[model samples]
Target: MHELTNETQGARYSPTSIRATWDGTGSVKDASRALGFSRAKGYDLVRRGEFPCRVLRIGRSTRVVTASLLRVLESGEPEYSGGHTGHCTS
Candidate 1:
């Protein structure tokens, strides 16, 4: 999933609204913006392979899996386990 940040060079968006929105795929910048991280940091995470989700590369474009991100945020755990392990009150 993609994390959104303030530095993304695109339309303005609120964090909560973006988090609640899902489209299955997003660019690197879009993910960074959603996660509130700098574009530079987002790329850095990609380079270090520390990002919690997988990134899909098609040609020169990179996209984050929105479902995985939403799952992690909603459950506070990775998405590979088939079910969320964390509890959400809301």
Candidate 2:
């Protein structure tokens, strides 16, 4: 997980860029960046239980399962499918 610096606020947040390979875990923003998902839309998908990748919550932190993400990206189907569209969101 890479920590991206916000120049406007000098704040740091995790957002996995495309250049960075999936490493089993990352923030929602990270997955968002990987899939070109807007921040709001990414969280919305999570809240709706329809995100393309698996979301893991630990306390206040949210993690996207890299393996699951990769599966979806490679196959357009979530590993734990249960009525999800399995469509890649651009």
lDDT of each: 0.59, 0.63
Which run of 10 residues does model 2 get worst, by summed lDDT? Answer: 8-17
Q: Evaluated with lDDT, which candidate comes out highest?
A: 2
Q: Per-residue CA lDDT of candidate 2, range 1-90, in tens?
A: 133433422222223333264467867886766565687888888877778877777777878887777667667665532244764433
Q: Model 2 residue 10 lDDT?
A: 23
Clashing pairs in 2: 16-30
The list of candidate 1 runs beyond 4 A from truth reads 1-22, 78-90
Best by TM-score: 2
lDDT value, candidate 1, whole model:
0.59
| Ten contiguous residues minimizing lDDT sum, candidate 1 | 80-89
Runs in model 2 deviating more than 4 A are 1-22, 79-90
Q: Score residue 34 of candidate 1 by CA lDDT.
A: 56
Model 1 C-alpha lDDT per residue in residues 1-90, reported as the tens digit of each score: 134443343334343545566567767676676565778887887676555555666677867777656655556564432133452313
